[model samples]
Target: MNMSRRKFCGVGLLAVISPLGFPAFANPSARVRVGVLKFGTVNWELDTIKHHRFDAANGVDVEVVYFAGEDASNVAMLAGDLHVIVSDWLWVSRQRSEGEDLTLAPYSTAVGAIMVRQDAPIHDIPDLVGKKIGVAGGPLDKSWLLIQGLAQRDHKIDLAKEGEIVFGAPPLLSEKALSGELDAVLNFWHFCARLEANGFRRLIGAHEAAEALGASGPVSALGYVFREKWANENPDVAMGFIKASAAAKKLLADSDTEWQRLAPIVRADGRELEVLRDRYREGIPNRPLADEERDAAKLYAILADLGGERLVGKASQMAPGTFWAALKT
Candidate 1:
């Protein structure tokens, strides 16, 4: 983690500076406040947890605050407006370095895949050289870093200069690829799943790439993060949230029929729905982060290589408490 102070405060820095005097969160009995993005697969799990009263049944009262995007959510979390949110551990790690005292829990092992057109000339990672391969998320994106690892391992090529790389929002990547404006796309799993129904071929999954590149075991690409201050004060609520999420995952992982039950959230039907369901099924994690040392190592290594100090910072390893095992039950 080679992140410097200025480079580290790259996004919404003004917001985090004010949390110093933001009134302390004084809830004697925990009324856990969580935040979420407007849409994503995590929403479905959160929904199931709510509809089934998984949180309540676990004796946790939870309030979910939905945000427009990550920036607002990050601001709120740092300001102590929210206790917990699901996100990449990179963000949590950076905040922890800055003294926010955050901790992480698992949310998903499922991740998006790299894909190519059915008739594309590229047959392997090296074939991607000099081709127009679109990527979603910014440079520090997980999928992008995973692919960089693929290149670093097999082809010994720097993908940044090796290909015509287009980075933008996820929808634009799919739209361009579908219109033949790009040769292939590395995109969100949901977007890649939809493309599969249209005859797109999977190249490699983010998690699969990390494992093949020398991770300890299968690892999740996303997880839940919460302020240690809140989690410390109300350990039961924190543990309840974890158990409830695990329960929701078990429900869905054990039954594909549960996908149809979430049709409104899936937002697709027919063959497309089937593809998404199958992709999600394929992504369920077999264990927790504590068990994925190699996977975590690869994640930090890849991010360090691709994103430099901007993402991983100067540390040679993931920050302490990046994965919260204290509440593991």
Candidate 2:
């Protein structure tokens, strides 16, 4: 970090150029800067991590930087203001291709679902035909692309053309779907949980779609990311963060008391609490990425086919460092 920004960029490859080794995690007291969104279930897990002192227990001091929105957090990361951020692989792959050297470590596989008002007659992909469907992340949303890919693969239907699509914010999507302005909707797990709380029903979920799409294990798309150079230099901090998060995930899974403690923060109550917890249980991956895993690769392929370079950028292949192969090591 002693070099000026221009000098750092002039070095070409993102590999660390420091002759002196970066601080090792053995010291146990150094804090790793981590960024977290202020809302959503990730916030709940992070709060658990802090409240339980998971970072200190693992011999790494984690400095949690809170961002009100994911976009602000992403901007903070790109500006080199933080060590890690939770985001999807599509952004990581696109950034890596642009010489940013970002890499991913698995977190949760929790994803969105296709939901409809309780009274709606729609039941399956075919039923979506000629109906107005509300979408949270818009046309290029990875989950939407996955369903499109699944439909094309199994039923030979193109959802992009078969349904009337409405793109809007998650809150608006929920409001419209509930008020009957939209016949159905696709929203992230958290949004879907609240929808179910309000009597909306899922027509399909990501887990089911992943299984139908031939994903080998849990279909993981989002995770924690950091610069490859920084991780290689601070090996212990990198591994400690991963190990500590895994612990928090396990705790969230096994303890009802802990779930109760986190309920208010996660915005769960009554039946919505059950819905969110079930989504959490389903999302924890059985294992991190291994050589044979193709979930991320398949998503990339689907996005490419659906949206082309405009969405995924010009990377013709999966970025080499996109999935940190070292987590399982």
Candidate 3:
């Protein structure tokens, strides 16, 4: 058979045989069920993977299940309804500390930022003192902790003590900032991107705060998390999924055409779309896994100190198996 025909037949056969187990004569293609937020930014890459058949190219069938919220996805993950889920490594670390066997492969380094109206008087962290600050993700938000850590370390200013802090959802906080009810707002990356498009300026980014607090480089706050035991048993499938993910990221990084195609689903246009695309591209994790892990260890220490037992659980340091070492290549 010709190459194209053979490839088509292979895909067809794999789909048919996947549920019954691979026949001895054919190469196996594993099906990986991934759970993700319904409208999360991760969808951009996942859509790229599907559009380009990256999963099939890498010997896996990618089945994406959408969840409404992180809590729902986490519940599905723990219930074994998902083979993988996009989540923060810190939560994976906490799970591991609590005797779960989860491990994470770095996904994105895109973190939140403190935003202010373009003409707001806040010029630096110290200026945030005595201002009405709207913070998303509540008291133990990692970005908030990092910013707090930087303030305390550098200027000896306690943000939580000095500022009138109000915690709320990212959208609500963003609206409040826009309406001038807040002097500054720290919000999730996507919201920050929107705020940037709307003439808001970043007072400080989470990445900058992380760097100021001694992280070696841009550390990925989020990743594809799955049980280590499952990955070990299905090494080829795990590697294949990781490969597909990387391929999707590369497509996103290289092609504006892909972004154009994604515009509708991303539900953005003009400057908002442009800012979102650029920010997402910027957030892609390009550092070596070893470097990322090292930075994660350092940041974990800082967060543990600031967020205490509530954020990190019983672990004094990041658990050894927190980052999957097998995907290093």
Candidate 4:
């Protein structure tokens, strides 16, 4: 049967107008993509992803992927590929101020410390002058903060101008320092212990570093994050991850046997599992972000005075209301 052009046009229009038609099939529900750091410990969040802690039978399906570092994880979040980032707090203020819809949800475990060689000419923070100081990553700001804090208290040295430090991520600095590739290095957790056993000296721990900076104890060190829009849409999944994570934290915190349980899953470059076990027991602690607005404000004030004013607006404004509220129970 030959159809007229007007009839053909009318049929095409009907296809577009049909509510219960195949056009509905074109759209698909988004799967939750979670990102983890490559060499990050067997913490609660990573364990949750590994052991399928979150339920898929509900509404949304969750998938886990590992990136080389937190920087890469942030890139994934910005690209909309990741629903959450279980990593550091440095990105929180930086991302939020940029107007990115990302928010911190809860705290993870305490990361570890910075180490130097025992016999190295450097004894105190002031000794790190023209001599090279190796950190895990080049220009590693986190490690550099230790030097900055020490300088501010002991010598009034300006980190921006007076400090000369270097950073190298994994295998690079660790391997080099072990094999005599560099002078002294800053390390974390298991790696710090390894450096000590291998004859490297302990210069400073993260907690001690914070203290020297004239601050109080164990500030909110590391934690998790999610896009604001994504978290709002999938509150169930968010809550599920948090619940599973809290459980893992309790397990790790309570017993020495659980530390052994985590050994096989945790890995570090040039560091043994036993060292990691000790680090896990001593260093990492599962704690929530505090209600101390003063400390939060202090961090912002320090960063701003240190030329990181571009990263945050005001110290008083840096509260963990939405994210911290999520961890109440």
Highest-scoring model, lDDT: 3
Which predicted model would earn the best TM-score? 3
- What candidate 1 gets wrong by more than 4 Å, as runs, is 1-30, 327-329
Task: Rank candidates, lDDT, best first.
Answer: 3, 2, 1, 4
**What is candidate 1's lDDT per residue for 214-325, written digit by digit as tens?**
7767676777888877777776667667766766766777777777889888798889988888777777666544575346865786677778887777675677777775
Give the per-residue lDDT digits (tens) of candidate 4, residues 1-329. 22222332234334333455331212134355678766566343356433533223222345678887777877888898877776555557666655766776445334445566677787776676565656664443554565566677678766445544566666567787787756666765556776766777776676676556655545555566787676666665555445444444444556656555555565433346556555555544333334323344555555555545444445335534424344433
lDDT of candidates 1 onward, in order:
0.74, 0.76, 0.86, 0.55
- Model 3's number of clashes is 0
lDDT of 3 at 134: 93
* TM-score of candidate 1 on Cα atoms, chains taken together: 0.86
* TM-score, one value per model: 0.86, 0.87, 0.90, 0.73
Please give, for residues 18-61, the per-residue lDDT of candidate 3 as tens digits: 55542231543388899998888888889988887777776787
User: Which pairs clash in the backbone of model 2?
Assistant: none
The digit string of per-residue lDDT tens for model 2 on 1-329 reads: 13222222233112223344333456633677889866756777777777876665655677888889989999999998998899988888899988998998777788899998788888788898888988889788878877878878878888888889899999899888888898889998889988988888989886677667766667576788888888888876676676567667767888878888887897777888887887788888665366324667765776777778988889866677787756543
What is every candidate's alpha-carbon RMSD to the true fold? 9.8, 8.5, 6.3, 13.8
Clashes of each: 11, 0, 0, 9
